[model samples]
Target: MLMKPLIIGQLKARLPIIQGGMGVGISRCNLAGAVALEGGIGVISTAQIGYDEEEFSRNPIEANLRAIKKHLQRAKEIAKGGIVGVNIMVATKQYAEYVKAAVEAKADVIISGAGLPINLPELVKGSVSKIAPIVSSLKATSIILKMWDRKYNTTADFLVIEGPLAGGHLGFHEDELVDIDMDAYQEEIKKIISLKKEYEEKYNQEIPVIVAGGIFDKEDVKRALLNGADGIQVGTRFVTTKECDASDAYKQAYINCKKEDIRIIKSPVGMPGRAIWNPFLEKLTKGRSEIKHCFGCLEHCNPKEVPYCITKALTNAVEGKLEEGLIFCGDNADRLKEITTVKQVMEELTV
Candidate 1:
């Protein structure tokens, strides 16, 4: 069957693919713009977006807010008219400001995850940019929809169901990650679709449901489409692309990774995250080094008590300090063979 265009608000993406947002400089303006140019919805991750700016370590929120417009402008220049969106984590210290920055930058859409974005509608009020909340289950989707409807009299432009196989900060607990079966998620997807239909009927609008996590090739996209998904969000595959903002060493890590290398590690932000097993991770597992001061980014984070500072580790990795940095990747990172351009990768997956 032929794939159809993905509609999010008034924007129509030629390919039903939303490039999953990676943070700490992975999916920056260059990568996102390339994906949009390739006919997909290119997403720029807003996690510590100003890490490259001077003094970001001292004031992350203010730095990131300033960087949002700069990145979006660069992405728009590269896209030349294609759809470009921003993926902001709800757990960030300045979530509201970042969302507003994206809106001000004329971002086509805003995809939020890592927590329930209950006030996302309110944050983007009066903006043309559509809002999408990423969820791990039907219950989360239901709760978000109901809250948005009741509080703001608004509905989501789209929904993203991110499964356990996704990289970075997971919504599920460490134990639940291993225990929950993929088959069970199917029912959850069905329930979310049903809930979406209810809201669509009430609001007289269509809410597109996109499935994410562990999606690799065309076969994976096909499975999602067959299972009631209007599109798919892919992350790890995009990491190996030429346009990705991550260092060459980081992409090489994905290319060289083995199946056993991908494992869940305890993040300093009090959440379980998936990453490639590297020398740094091995050292972390052995508890060899003492963690330095925390950056105080996440609300639940306790730097003095947690394992290590996630922002520092991730920023280090993105800066090419592979030996002492945390390298986040999806379970399918092991399957990647070589580096390719974003245009080539999208063509392979969509065609």
Candidate 2:
């Protein structure tokens, strides 16, 4: 299959790839900027992004908003005019404000998921930043497209189809994912690609479909393209890259993990997430761990009630306190044996 540049609105990527957005200081200015500079789309995850700011502990909202601009500006500077985007989870507390912040900061693209982004179009109206909704099935694609059309007379600039094998918060339940059928999911992807045609024709524009989850190598990219996807969003493979913002130990965790070490766990935000089996997770199996402080990152999180404090756990892992922090990863993380650069990964996928 021949690689084609992914065009979303006026933005263009030399390769039809996007460095997956990892939160809790994982994919930030360094990784994102490198990906864009290397000719692919770079995405900064805005989840608990303010963790590094001094005001994060006192006023998370303001800190997170400030981090959005701070990171976006720095990422853009490193990008050197290349396309840079932000992944804004709808599950975040100030979802609308984050969307506005990304647009205000002049983000080239805004890909949102972790919940249905029903009001995304409204929040980004009159901005040049392209919007994409991360969906898992045709039903989700239909709902988002229909809702966007009915409510705002617009459609997604692109669509990211995340499958069951994805990391972090997944769209599918744990039960359904245990015996997921890739062939059946590919059929759903075909249908979604077909579904987008209607909206594309109506708006007289193209709506690219990007498949995520389990996409790791050139063959994976080839297969996705042959199956009708315009591009692929990669997370775990990028985690081990030198430019990734996570701590060295965090990247090493990907290299040291075994295939059996990966499994799904219930996130405190009420979603199933995939992560490595570590000391903290093993301890959780015995009983729930109490959260000392709540960052109030997710919209539905309660300080008193939840399996674990997501912000603290993710922050711990990103900072290299692996035993205490929850490290979210894709199923194929075990395949990584060494660290690489973003340029190498992009060339391997597109060459």
Candidate 3:
């Protein structure tokens, strides 16, 4: 059967896929625009988006704000009226400012996670940009719905359920990540769907639920739809696509890895993340690596404490300095066998 289109509020994508926003310059305008052009929702990650800006190190905030507009413009140019969105983590230092930037840039949607986005409606107030929150558990989903309903008198345009197998920052605990039961996790997704129905009835709006994490192939997409998700969000699979913004070496890391190479590591933001084990991470495991600079990217980061600079490590990875970088990926990153184009990947997923 052919895949169905995803409808979130007034926005509709010809494909039921939303590319997860990978950060540190991994999924910029290049990959996002390409996906949007193919009738899928393209999402630009706002995390450390200005890393390549000339004044990034000195004026990170201003640089990011400016780049948000620049990159979105480029994505729009490639999209040709297709749906383009931005992903802004709630844990960022200037979370509200980033939301404002995305809205001002005229993003069709704003997907937020890395923390509960209780105040998301307020930030996007009066804007046409739809807001979606990524969640891991039914409790988090319930909390967000209640808060948004009671405080803002609004509901999410859609919801993204990211399981523990996802890359980058996870909403689950370290212990939960290690021994995740697929059946139990699917049950959680269904519970969230049931909870969302209450709000849908109250607000008289459709709340499409998109499932993510470990959704590697067409079968995964079928399973998600059968399990009550209206769509699926994919991250690792996109990294191997030609349109990905990351360098060749970065894509090679995914192509070259075995299933055993994937491991869970501690993120500086006090969350457990799934990434490929590399020499840089191995060195940090033996001892704390020195912090070279503070990018002021995260709300919980302190220059004086924590592990190595996450921004720097991720930047190194995207730049293809594998030995000195942190390569974030989903549990199936190692399953990627070769580089492919975004159009081909989309075709395979929809097939």
Candidate 4:
């Protein structure tokens, strides 16, 4: 077995693996805490963190901020001594507030994506939490590194390269996502590595780069390492785990899904998202359903102009309302065969 501890500056994990953050209440305290307890870094997604709170639909900010501490405290209790991190999307409506809450909750690491986290260092200042940005290309990495360096006099503690094949909202446009060659992405990876090396030379710091999106099994892990990734982030595989916070129906959907059933759908949040084709999606595509509410979660979303409310759809899924909820999954979700525990899944991936 290839077991190399991933060193993200001062933070270290027994396994060079990160449990990719799943949102809309999917990977919560239980899932993240279990992964950390099992030796890998467990990441809680900040996307709709206040998902189950009673006032989430009314006061998303207060609810989400409160949920951050709740989730972090629960994760810490389960972690015992392991690492726990949180993923907050930059495109979120309350990005700064959520990031500050994560820091205040004493999270070990904070991963931001969906846009360049130019102000991450500022949000995390005076805190011990490490900051990382998920980028899909070197251009994005360069832009972030320059901004962080110039503005905050800080370098990234770590970096994540999210490829087009990964689930949920993608960094690339829909057409580019399907049309780009994987071979071309390899160059982007190399450029990011080179950029990391440049910073290493200038600042005399070592920054670890992790790759995510569409990663499955040990074979995928090996491929990522070979491609210069310090570690790997796996998400969809964990959805079917016993410790996963998602509903049983959600897990079963992955197991029962075929490759063709996984398709890209327009998020009311103004981004293209990958999800399992379900009754909810069918209704949205056919314009048979009307969005009853909007949470103003994403900055670009307008309930009046969009097809449906993303917050409502995701919340429904989280609460087990399968027929009316949108279920997000990665490209490899169709390969899931059975549900397992978090420990079992970690062992399989680490091996």
lDDT of 4 by residue, 1-351 (tens): 655898987888999889989889998999999999998899999889887889987888789999998999899899999999999999899799999999999999999998889998999999989989999988899999999889988899999898988888888888876675888887889889988998878788889989988788888888888888888898998999998998898888889999999998777666788999998898776674576766768977767778777788888887778899899999899999998998888888885
Name the better of 2 and 4 by lDDT: 2
Residue-by-residue lDDT tens digits, candidate 1, 150-210: 9999899999899999999898889988776888888889888987999999999989999
Ranking by lDDT: 3, 2, 1, 4
Off by over 4 Å in 4: none
Top lDDT prediction, candidate number? 3
- 194-220: candidate 3 lDDT, tens digit per residue: 999999999999999999999999898
lDDT of 3 at 173: 85
In candidate 1, position 1 carries an lDDT of: 57
Once model 4 is optimally superposed onto the true structure by TM-score, how far is the C-alpha of residue 59 displaced, in angstroms? 1.5
The alpha-carbon deviation from the true structure for residue 162 of candidate 3, after best TM-score superposition, in angstroms, is 0.2
- Colliding pairs, model 3: none
TM-score of each: 0.97, 0.99, 0.99, 0.97
What are the lDDT scores of the predictions, listed in order?
Answer: 0.89, 0.92, 0.93, 0.88
Give lDDT for model 3: 0.93
What stretches of model 2 exceed 4 Å from their correct place? none
The alpha-carbon root-mean-square deviation between model 1 and the true structure, to one decimal in Å, is 1.3
